[model samples]
Target: MTEPLPHPQLLLAIAALRDRALAADSLNALGFSIANDPYPLLQYHQALVFQQQGQSLELLCVSGLARPSEDSPYLVWLQRAVRWIATQLDDDQPRWLGRDALTPPADIAEGWAEWWPKGLWCIPLHDRDGQRLGLVLFLLDAAPAPALQPLFEGLWRTWAHCWASFARQRRLLRWRPGKRQLLLALAVAVALLLVPVRQTALAPAEIVSREAMIISSPIDGVIQSMQVRPNQPVEKDTPLFSLDETTLNSRAEVLGKEVAVADAELMAASQRAFDNPQSKSELTLLHGRVQQRRAELAAVKAQLQRTQVRAPRAGVAVYSDPNDWLGKPVSTGERILLIAEPKQPAMLIQLPVADAIALEPGAEVTLFLTAYPLTPLKGKVLETSYQAQANEEGVVAYRLLASIDGQPEHARLGLHGTARLYGERVVLGYYLLRRPFAALRAWSGL
Candidate 1:
C-alpha cells in the first residue's frame, strides 16, 4: 500500500503554520509556539541581521524552545553560543559558511547540546546576487523528522530569495538621481570651487582722555531744577545743572559778617602792636583769627559753587540715572552727559585671538563698511589690548585700534563691517577645483 505522500493537504497546513509563526511581529508569541510544541531536546533559536554601517551581524531576535525563566540554564548557554558565532562572522571567516548563515556559530548543530539538550539550525538570508544580508536560527522542540528537513529548507529558500530581491531594489533606488538633483549638486560644487575668497583688513582706532568730578552740596536743600539732559555735550565751565541756593546764601551771609569782624579786630591789634611791642601777643592772636576767617570765607565760596554744576571739559555730557546717584540733597557726582569730539573718529577692530597674535602696531589693514561697500578704507594698527574679550558669539578676540586715512563721507559710529587680514595666499589653477569631485567618485565606487 503506497502511503499517499504525507497528505498534500497536511503538508500545506504545516507549511502555513510555519509561515504564520515566522511572520509573528512579537518575539514573545514566537517563543510561545516553539515552547508549546511537543518537541523534546528543544534548544535555542535566534535571528541575526546585518548592519551596513558597521559591516557586522548583530542578534536581532532570540527564542527558546523551553519555558521562559530568568534562572533558565539554557539562556546563559545560548548567549555564550551567540557570542562565539558573532566573533567568527566579525572576522569574515570561511568556517561560518562565508556569511551564508545569518546566525553566529555557523556550525550550530555541533555545539547545540553543549549549551542545550538539542541542536539548532541556522538559515542565511541573501540578496539576489547571493550577498549575505541576515540569518535565522531555530532550536528543535523535538528530534525533527528527517522528512521535516526538506520542508524547512524549502521554506527558507522561498523567503531568502524574496528578501534578497527586496534588498537589491533598495540599493538600486539609492543610486538613482533625477535631472534637477544632478544639476543642483553640480552647481553647488562649481560655486565652491570658483568663488574667490576675500582678504579681511583691520580698522583704525584712537585713544581719548577721560575724567570724572564729584558735585556735592555745602548746604542741605531740595533739588531746585535740572538744567542739563543725559549725553548733552558741554564745554569746560559750562553750566551742567542748578540747585536751590537759598540755604547756601544764608550761610554765606553769616560767614561774611564773621570775616568783617575779624578784619576789624586784626586792624586794631596791628596798630597797638606798632605802638607797644609788649602788645605783640594780642597782635599774634588777631592774626590767627584773620587767617581762620579767611579760610571760612574760602569754604563758603566753594560751597556756593556747588549750587551750579558745570562741565570741566569740551566733551559730551553724560547723565547717570538718579536712582544710582548716592542719596544726597541734590545730585552728587551724578554724570549729566558725555560730550565726545566728533571730528576725530577712530576705527575699532576686534580680531580673533589667533589672528590678533600675528598683528603688530604697524600692521596694515583694509576696512569695508556694510553701508558703503564701494569704498575701501586703509588703516594701520595703532594698539591692541593685552587681554582678550569675548564677542557676542562667545569667541575670545583682542580689541585693536587702527587709524583710518580718511573717514567715509557717510561714516557713523557703531557701523557693522568686516575687516580682512591679508594672510599668506596660495595660487592654484581653476581646473584643480575638480579634485574634490574626483575623490568623491572614488569613494562611492561610481
Candidate 2:
C-alpha cells in the first residue's frame, strides 16, 4: 500500500528548529511551507500574540499560502477581532471551535476565512514560567486523522515554545528601568515641580550709552581731515572733523564778486537818478539786486563755516579711527560717529523671536559680561518692543531696554554680555511645556 502523507506539524517543527539553529532567516517561509505540504491539510495557518499588559491581539505572521501584507484589509479585520475577543480570553482555558463558535463579529470571522472554514484549533504558547505568550491558529475543513494527534501535539508544543522563547528574548532586550531608578526619577521630578523659581529668558546684551549722541554730516561733502581722535574727550563746540571746502570756497568767491558788482551799479544808478528823474526805478531795482547778492554771499559763508564739524556736548569722540574719515564722502544726515558722555550705561538686549520672554517694567535682569563671565551684574527692564525687528546680529528679535544697576567701573561702553530677564513666576513644568504647547495649539488651531 502507498504510504500516507506525513503530518504537516512535524515538518514545520523540524523546519522551525533547523532554520533557527542554523541561523538562517527562513522564518518568513515557514507558514506557507507547512500549509502547502499535503500532510495534515490546512486551509490557513497564522500566528497571533496576546499581550498581558495591553490585553490586545495582533497577527504576527501568516502561512505563505495566504499571507497578508501589513496594510491588508484582512489584518484590519483581525485587529478588530482581537479587541472583541480580548474580553472572551478571561481565563487561560484551551479552546477548540467551529466557525459558528467564534466570539468575533460574523462579518470579520466569515470574511477572514473566505471559504467559511470548518474547524479551528487554538493552541496556547507559554513560557517556562507558564505565562501566556500567544496562540497558534490552525484552520482545516476536517479534524486530523486520529493517528496524527500525538505527532500534532508534540510538534505544536515545540513550535510554540520556540516562539515564546523568542518573545521573552525581545522583552528582555527592551527591559524597562528598575524600581529604584524609577523611584529616584519620580522624586527628582516632584522636587522640580514644587520648587519655586523665576521664569527667565536669555539673550545677548550690550552696554549702550544712556546719553549717546550721533554726529552726522550737515551737507554732502568729502572729509578733508579729522580734528579729534577716537575716544578723545571733547567739550561742546570742539571741532570734530573738517570736510573738503573747495567747492564752497569757490562759490563764496563768486557771490562776493556779484555783491561788489551790484553795489557799484547801485551807486552809479543813484548818481544817474539824481541827475535825471527817469533813472529812479532803475536805481531801486539795482538796490534790491545788491541785497540779494549779499544774502547769497552770507549763506555760502555759513556753509563754509560749518565745514569744520564740531562736537555738540561734553563727551568722547567714539569713532574707531581718524583714517576712516579722511577723504570719505558722506551724505547729509549720515552719522559720522557717536558722542556719549562717560556716565551710567544702559543695557540693549536683542531677544530672538524663538526665545522671546514677556516681561513688564521693573522685571529683574542679570548680565554676564563676556570679559568676566563669572561675575554677574544686575539690571531692570525699562522698555520692550511690541514687534520683532532684525538686530545687528542678523536675527529677527524683540529689542529690550534695561537700566543697569550697581555696575562696576570696568563695565564700560560697548561691553557685550548675556542678559537673562525674569518674567512672572511659573511652575517648572509649566515653563518647560509653555512653548511646545503653544506651538502645538497654534499648529492644530485647537
Candidate 3:
C-alpha cells in the first residue's frame, strides 16, 4: 500500500521547528521551542518540557508561558507525576500515556483529573549517543497522525543536541561564590588560624656532664702528652695529662747551680773571715745571696712538680682526641678536658640567635642523637644564657642547658645531635609565621 505524503504546509512547519531548535542559544530558549514551536504540525492544548536533573525531572518550560511559575499547583503536580512517568518508561521512545494504560501511584492519580488530559503523547529526547536527556509531553485534542512521527523525531534530535551542549557548557563554568559564602569561608580560615599549638625550634645540641669537674692547664706551657685516653675512666689523683717539663727542668738546674755556688762562696767567705777582717763584711753579703738563691730554687722545683696534671676526682676523662692536645700550648686555667661522672648527663644546646624563640625554664626538649637517631631522648631546659656567644662552629648562638628526664642508656656524654625545643603555647598562625615575622622585622628595622 502507498503511504500518503506529508502535506506541504505540515512539512514547512517541521522545517521551521527544526530551524528554531537549532538556533536556540540557551537551555531556556531550547525548552521554549520544544514546548511551543510544533503547534502548527500537531494541534495540542498544551505542551510541557522537562530535563533530567540528577535522578529527578525538572520542568523547564510550559507552552504559552514566558516562565513556568514554580508555585503553580499544576507545575507542582506535574513535576511529581513526570518523575513517576520517567521511571515507568524503560526505553527512550515516543509513546502514548493514558490513566488506564499505566496505573500511577495514588498521589499522582489524584492530580490527573484536574491538571492533565485523559491521553497525551510522551516523546523522550535523546542525544546523539542514545542517552535520554529530556522528555516532552504533548496534550493533543485528537490523536497525532502517523505521518507526524518522523518529523517529531527529527525535531527532538535537534533539541536534544542543543540541550546537551548547553548542559556541558554550564558544567564547565566555575561557580562564583556569593558575598555570604565568601564571608563564611573567611571566618572558617580565621578560626583555623586561632587554634593553639606549641611553638618549637630546632638547634644543635650535645650530651654533656651536668656537674663535671673542669680540667684546666695549671701553668703556661706546651702540653707534653696525655696520661689517659679520651673517655677513659680515671681514679682520684690519677695522672690525666702533663706539660713539657724541659724548660722547668733547665730553670731548676740553673737555680740549683746558683744555690750551690752561693753556698760555696758563703763558706769561703766565712773561712777567710778568720784570716782577714775585710772578708768578714763579704760573709754577710754572701750569706744573704745564698738564702735568696735557695728561695728561687725552691720555687722552680714546685713549678716542676705542677707540670704533670692529675685528676682531682674519680670520673671519666671527656675530651677530644689526645693527639689534638699533644704539643699544644695552653695558658694557666685554660680548660683542656672534663672529669665527668657517667651518671650525670645533660644536654647543651647552641640555638642560633636568628632562630631563637622565647623559652622558659623547664621547657620540654627532645634530643635526636646522631648515633641513635631512631631513638630520641627527652629532657627539660634547666638554664639558658642571656646573651648570644660564638660557638665552636663560629655561629653566634644562645647557650641552653637541659637535664635528661631519665637515665637512658644512649645518653652518653660527648654525643652530638639536634634538639627540638618547645616553648609556650601560641596561636597556630603565630607559630607558623614567627620566623618570617622576625626576618621581616630585622630587615625593615621595625
Better of 1 and 2 by TM-score: 2
lDDT scores for all predictions? 0.56, 0.73, 0.88
Clashing pairs in 2: 32-64
Which has the better lDDT: candidate 1, or candidate 3?
A: 3
Please, what is the TM-score per model? 0.48, 0.58, 0.60
RMSD of 3: 19.3
lDDT accuracy of residue 334 in candidate 1:
41
Per-residue lDDT tens digits of candidate 1, residues 1-446?
87336657657755765675566444334334333331322223443332222445544434432334535665545555655554544321112232322444445544463543343444555555656655555543343555555555555554555455555666777997889999999988767766554333343322221233444443445556556655556678887656677777887788889989998988887788888988788877888888887888788788777767666667654446544332336444443345555445556777876444256686776777787778866767777788898877787878877666774554444456776655323223233433565568879989
Best by TM-score: 3
Worst ten in a row by lDDT for model 2: 24-33
Which ranges of candidate 2 are over 4 A from the true structure?
Answer: 1-175, 178-191, 320-324
Best by lDDT: 3
Candidate 3 worst ten-residue window by lDDT? 140-149
What is residue 106's positional error in candidate 1, in angstroms? 23
Q: Model 2, 63-156: lDDT tens per residue?
A: 5435457687767676776555544545444455566665567776677578336665555655677676665556666555565555556555
Candidate 2 versus the native: TM-score? 0.58
